[model samples]
Target chain A: MKKVLIAGASLTKVGDHWNKSLLDLAVEAGSAALKDAGIAIPDQIVVGNMFSGFSSLQENLGAIIADSLMLQGTPALKVESSGASGAMACNVADSIIRSGQANSVLVIGVEKMRDMEPNDAVHAASLGESASFTQFFGISQTAMCALLTHLYMQEFEISRDELSVFPVIAHKNAVPAEHAQFRKAITITDVSRSMPVSDPLRLLDCAPVGDGAAAVVLCSENGQTKNAEAEISASAASTDSLNFFQRDDMFDFTATRRALAKALAFAGLSIKDIDFAEINDSYSSVAALSVEALGFSKRGEGVRDAKEGKFDLNGKIPISTFGGLKGRGNPIGATGVYQIVEAYRQLTGTAGANQVKNAKTGLLHNMGGIDSSAAVHILRRVG
Target chain B: MSIAYWRERNRYYRILGSKCKECSAEFFPPVYKCRKCNSEKLAEQEMPKEGKVMAYTLSRDIITGFEDQEPMIIGLIELQNGVKMVAQIADASADQLAVGDKVKAVFRRVSVNGEAGQIFYGYKFVKIDK
Candidate 1:
């Protein structure tokens, strides 16, 4: 298979884009990425989005975005896997380029979540889980994560303060990120004292809803652009039971573990080889489970390690280099691509204050619906 | 929402799940195939009503049709037969709920489609006083 390289990337600051429409965000990010790559048009376009129809009353996003970008006549499509839509789109683009089907591909991840009412937005996000079994009972996604948090603490004997460290680190890292949504650092006391959206899961424990878009240009290894500095070494996806309660062990994120293992094997690297990581911390507990599943920490040690400064910027295997879902703002479908673009920034020495010194390799973990679906990508710096 | 809810009424009303005919292992919310033995030969079985609270959460951000039911308590209950299922904890306050507390299933209104849509009913759990 031919290797795929990220030629260029761009992102919009994540927040309430009351002035911008969904299509506007897409065009802005896509155009910026294309301009950065010095390409007039891409061979194909793939959009990753979660709920354009529900939030913006817009579907057929691919055609709309392509037409608005004035890149008509290109083969355009959209891929949705709940929160993992962004990474899934990138995976599709990678396959298209690796199979020699397309020489250049523009992958865009965009979402307009702030356009809808708070209740409607929560309902749309809960659609990521099972409609018949999970959502029928009217349990929001935050409630489910809160239950998982309670279980994790009870099972592993982890204290509330230890669990609160993930968001603290995320907010701290996000302070230096220009494109991050929550740039101000937050204290652990703030996380613990915040309003309880779901008991045991304060408001600060969850990623804020926002409008944002991120785009990346992918090309075959030999067809690199002038700014191309990183090659996608491995790309893989995996799935688990849709209902979190149905899994044998509710705390074990099987999809993340499977996908990350396959990605590392494909890249011929191990967990230790990863210099920096962009993990899916849509919720604080989810972040802990993700790191444990990815082998960065032993089982039941993820939150403890974070509290011990193991996941800090200068610590072993730095994660969430540019804020994360918690601090960076999670645009649902757009979050995965944000992670990819952030990794590209880290590997290319353009991460600014968030840069990890001598970073050579990085990993990106994005998931949909509490690890129901996950996509893992491994990238390495290329000269 | 009404059609899907009606189609699985038995599963919701009586806690009817699937039991593997080969191994006799049971599951809640049903399953396409046996998780234990991977056997497609499965039969519908009513799950035990009594269980224990393995974990629980109280949610203030209500979903659509659940606005009137804010601060809802949901729990993961482990049945007598080992099948685990998620359901709302009815008639209970945070102070009265705890892990390992005994609970029994009871039929109640789950939610309504909209202001004028059909009301969906399902099994909910109530703590059994010691």
Candidate 2:
């Protein structure tokens, strides 16, 4: 197998990008990643996005991005798996490198959300779930998470206040992150008191939607690139039932577990070797379920571990080091690539104030729907 | 949009799910293959109308088409045959509902396209008073 190295990484600040269109954000991030890779052209281009059809009424993104970047005639395509689109695109880029199909690939994940209304945006993002069974009756993805939250809390005997630990941690780390959306710190009480969107899920408990783009350059040994220091040690993906309630165990994030276990095996490293992680903390319940699935915490104990400072920057197995989906902001498909960019930053010793000490290895977990689709990746620093 | 829902009439109207002929296991919202025994031989089965609420949520983040049904109460209910499904809870406020409360599926109007559009119907759950 060929080695996939991170030749470049870049991201637009996550927020209401009323000034930029979807293609505009893609171009900005793509150009920066190209500049970072020190390459004038790439062997291939892959874009990851969700709901461009619904939100922007646009499609055929692969050709559009290649054309916008003025790199026409290069093979380009789009890969989408709802919220997991970003990491899934990277996974495809890795495959392209391993198969000797492309030596260097540009992977971009972008989303333009501010263009649509709140209700419409919710509907579009919820396309990740079942349409007939779940959405037909107007069930939003947040509602599905809400239903799961109630079950998880009831089964675990956990209170709503206790679940705020993950968001609090995310917000705290995001405070110093330059590209993060919610840079201000938030307290547990703040999370507990925020207006409720779905029962048991306060406004603070969910990741805010925004328009942003993130990009990365994957290069093989045969590719021409410079100033690269991290390699994708392992990449794996798996899927569970499209509907969360249909899974045999709602609390068990089977997709994440399978994907992470596979990734760890491929990397030949134990969970303890991971200095930090970028969790898909789109919601408090999701964050808890995700950490539990990653084996960073036992079932029903993710929030408890967070309260005890176990996931703190100075503690064992720090997560969401730059605020993650909650603190850093989520642009749907772009979020995973942002995590990859953040991981690359940490591995390159350039995370600034949010850096984990001696961060030699990192784990990134990104999922679509309610852990219905999952992708796990491991990145290692190279001297 | 109602035209899109025309094909699922049986599933929406009668709570028609699927049962595994091989393992005798059943599922709601149907399944292509048996989840229990992985059997492809499945039979169309009407689910028991009654079940207990496994969990519920009062969602104010209503989807675009569901604005009229503001702050909807959604529940995860386990039917008598051990099949689980999510459905809207009707005629019950959050204060009156509790986990383990019994609910039964009822035919109800789910949505309407507009003033002249078709009326879509589906099964929602109502709390069974003691």
Candidate 3:
């Protein structure tokens, strides 16, 4: 397989894009990426979207993006893996380049969730749940996560203050997030006092409904790989049961653990080797639990570490420096690629305000379909 | 809804599921497709209403329709049949919840979707008497 590199990347500020269509955002980011790489539109394009049925009621993303860009018949393909659709798109593009199927591939992940009411968007998002088990019972994703948070607290002797720190830190760091969806800084008290969505998950702890898009360019390393800034070192994905009922460990993210472990092993590194990380923090407690499952902190110790300022910008190990899904906003399909783009920015010293000091190595973790699918990648600065 | 489960809705509709007759893989809402073996053979099996709390959380802030309820408890329970599912925690404050505690499902108000103008109702779990 050929070595692949991220040649160029771009993104629209994640928030309510009421005036923008999916194609509009995709074209904007796609053009910006090409400009960044100093290249014209390539021979092929790959568009990744999670909820096309709800976003535009149109499933033909490839043709839509290509038509919008006026590059009809450019051999476009659409890919989806629930919310991780973007990252999965990246994996597909990388594989295509590495396998000699394409010289260059343009990947765009976009979602227009604000087009519908918040509840409808959430209901569409929860479509990933098993229709047989979860849908019949009507389980909200927040409630599902809240149940796990409650169990995690019980198993770890954790307190609300500990769990509250995650959202606090996420909001605090969002100050540097110029275009983040929710830029207001919050405190642990704010999180605790925020209105509850599901039990134990205050409104402040959850990511707001958002709309945006992110893009990246990939090519083989040999023939003019679009001026690489960072190398796609390793990407790994794993799956668990779609229904939460079949899992053994309610608090432990089995899929994340396996995916991260495999990715790190492939990269010949460990959590300590990572200078910074961008995790899927759809909820603050979920962020804490993700770090715990990644073995950054022992089980039940994540909240404690969080409470003690361990994940702050200047802390020993900072996470979600972009405010994460909590303060940055969760834009469904674009989230995973957004996280990767953030890591790329930090490693390249292009992240103006939120750049981690001397960040040579970074990691990105994104899960889709209620922990049923997870993807992890270790990125390195390659100049 | 099963005719039997619907008749028992006032108390709490605890739907039971069984494994595919050919594959032996269990499902919660009961299904025709055996996820494991893809066998098109299965049977309906009612789950024991009694179970232990597996995990839970206390939500503080409201989204849209739930603006009044500041904090609500949600939990997942493990039944004797080995099925796990999420339900709202009733008859107990957020402070009283803990993992592994015994609980049972009951009919309760679920949520307001903001469109239907109807109060969606479903089974929620309550702490069992010690």
Candidate 4:
């Protein structure tokens, strides 16, 4: 397989884009990517979308996006793995380039979640649950995470003060982004004051529903016609049981651990070798769990690391320099790709205000449908 | 009252999943097809009415069809049948709950679509009172 490099990337400010249709966002982001790469068109295109069928009541995204860009008949397709659809699309694009099937490919991830009412969106997302299992019992995603947070507390004796540290850091990091949704830095006291969404989880603790799109251009070494941000150092993905019940443990994500391990191994590095990271923070409790699972600290001690400012931009290893899904907004399918874009910007020194100091290697971790599927990628600076 | 086959079988108690004889994959609300191996051979199985609370949460922003049930405690419980299921946490405040705590099942009205609309009923878990 040939080595693949990211030629260009682009995105729109993530928020309520009610006036824009699904195809509009795709074209906007897709155009920005082509301009960034200095390429008019790619040999093939892949789009990542999770809920256009229900939220917008539309389908045939491959055709819609391709037609809008005036790149018709360029061999287009759509990739979906629930929330991780963006990263999944990137993975497919990379594979195509490495296999000599396509010299260059355009991978775009977009989700228009904020267009619908809050409850309507929640119900639509809940369809990811097993119809005969969790959905039949009427369980929603917030409740599912709240349940996991409660379990983690019971097992580790986690303190509310501990869970309080993540949002504090996230809001602070996101404040200067200018494009972030919740840009105001928060305090532990504020977290406690927010209304409870679920026991042990407050309204502020959950990621907000937002709309956004991100795009990446991947090409083989031979196809590089312009300077780009970075190269695909390594990437690994794994799957797990969709329902949380089948897993032997709630706090532990076997897929995440395995994928990270494989990724680190492929990159010929370890956790300590990573200069920064972007982990899935669909909920505050998840941020606390992922830092520990990624070997930043012990399982129960992730909260301690956050409290000490270990994950801040200037600390030992910064995480989510883009405010993450918590403060930046969770745009479902577009989230994972957005994280990679942030890392790429940081490594290339393109991040205006949120850039880490002389960063080299960065890690990206995303979980799809609770813990059912996971994708981890390692990026390096080559520019 | 007329109901779906799965709902009809669960009217007397909480719904349980049975694994297919041709494929040993268990399902909740019982199913005729095997999720794996796709075999018609199946066996009837009852879900344990009592289990340990594995995890839980309380949702404040309620959905449209479940506005009245706002701030509800939802949980994952491990049944004696070696399966885990998500259900509502009934009969207790958020503070009284913990992981691994014993809980029993009870039928309860989950939500009402409208003032005159159909009332949704399902099994909810309550702490086992000493």
* TM-score of every candidate: 0.97, 0.98, 0.85, 0.90
Model 3 chain A poorest 10 in a row by lDDT: A130-139
Q: Which 10 residues in a row give candidate 4 chain A its minimum summed lDDT?
A: A129-138
Interface RMSD of each: 1.1, 0.9, 4.5, 2.4
List chain A TM-scores, every candidate, in order. Answer: 0.98, 0.99, 0.96, 0.97
Task: Arrange candidates, best lDDT first.
Answer: 2, 1, 4, 3
Using DockQ as the measure, name the better of candidate 2 and candidate 3: 2
Interface RMSD of 1: 1.1
For A69-157, candidate 2 gives per-residue lDDT tens digits of 99999999989999999999999998999899998999999999999999999998899988888778898999889988988998898
lDDT of candidate 4 over A215-300, digit per residue (tens): 98888877767866688777788888776656766677777888889889987998988999998887888888788768887878
Residue-by-residue lDDT tens digits, candidate 1, A1-383: 79798898999999999999999999999999998887788999999999899899999999999999999999899999999999999999999998999889999999999998898889889989777767888888888888888989888998878888999999999999999999999988999899889889999999999999999999886566575789899999999988787788887899999999899999999888999899999888999999999989899999989988999999998888989999999999999899889999998999999999999999999999999999999999997
TM-score of chain B of 4: 0.78
* Residue B92 accuracy (lDDT) in model 2: 91
Name the better of 3 and 4 by lDDT: 4
Question: What level of docking quality does candidate 1 show?
Answer: medium
lDDT of 1 by residue, B70-89 (tens): 88999988999988878899
Worst window of 10 by summed lDDT in candidate 1 chain A: A220-229
Candidate topping TM-score? 2
For TM-score, candidate 2 versus 3, the one ahead is 2
Error of 1 at B34 (Å): 1.5
Compute the lDDT of residue A378 as modeled in candidate 1: 95
The true-versus-predicted C-alpha distance at residue B65 of model 4, in Å, is 1.7
Cα error, candidate 1, residue B70 (Å): 0.4
